[model samples]
Target: MTGKLTAQPGKREELADILLQAAEGMKDNADCELYLVNVSEDDPDAIWVMELWRSAEAHTNSLKDPAAIALIQQARPLIAAIEPVKLRPVGGKGF
Candidate 1:
């Protein structure tokens, strides 16, 4: 999935810290093939995340994880919204 996240106009640094820490735990999950985070060039506060899991089950399971939940809670306020759009790669390198 991929989407944008904008911090409050002046809270970019703090928001980045929270998001980075929140993602620390998710990096080790075996089911996650890719979990990339990016800051929008046009919108400094906007963060774009791209995640690829081994299966839908893995993604679902992550939702129930405590670490994931905590991270969500921590970043909720800093995030304006999570506009994730699902995708399926048809060809070429998917990494």
Candidate 2:
């Protein structure tokens, strides 16, 4: 899943940092295949997160993780909007 998140005007960097922390926590989860966070070159407030999980269930269950839940709570106030793009992977270099 690819997620586009717009942060409050001045909170982009902070939100990115929090997201990185959350990704770091995911390192311990075997189901998390890949997690990458990128900032938009044109818009400082825009951030993108790319995630690949072992399965849809794993992705859904990740939302219930304590660390992920805490990160979501912390990020909620700074986030303006969330746009998710779901994709099906056929084959990938990393995978």
Candidate 3:
């Protein structure tokens, strides 16, 4: 899934850091194929995250994981809004 989120003013970096931590935590999760984060060049408060999961069920179950929950809790307050982007993966070089 692809998502764009706006951080609370002045908290973009903190949000990115938390996402990076989440990426680290996902390293051992076989269900998670990708957990990529990028900051928007135009919007200072905007950060984008791209995720590739083995399945929808896998992604849902991940939300209940303690480590994932902790990261979400840390990031919740810093997030102003989250907008999901509709995209499908066919094939890619890095992917």
* Candidate scoring better on lDDT of 1 and 2: 2
- Compared with the true structure, all predictions reach lDDT values of 0.75, 0.94, 0.94
Most accurate candidate by TM-score: 2
- Local error of candidate 1 at residue 27 (angstroms): 2.9
TM-score for each candidate, following the candidate numbering: 0.83, 0.96, 0.94
Of the two candidates 1 and 3, the one with more favorable lDDT, higher being better, is: 3
**Model 1: per-residue lDDT, tens digit, 1-95?**
66667777776667777767656777788888877777778887777777788788899998898877887787777766667688976657865
RMSD of 3: 1.0
In Å, residue 37's CA in model 3 sits off its true spot by 0.7
Model 3: residues >4 Å from true position, as ranges?
none
- Candidate 3 C-alpha lDDT tens digits along 5-70: 999999999999999999998999999999999999999999999999989899999999998898
Deviation (Å) of 82 in candidate 2: 0.7
lDDT of 2 at 6: 99
Q: How do the residues 1-95 of candidate 2 rate in per-residue lDDT, one tens digit apiece?
A: 99999999999999999999988998999999889999999998999999999999999999998888989999999999999999988996976
Deviation (Å) of 90 in candidate 1: 2.0
lDDT of 2: 0.94
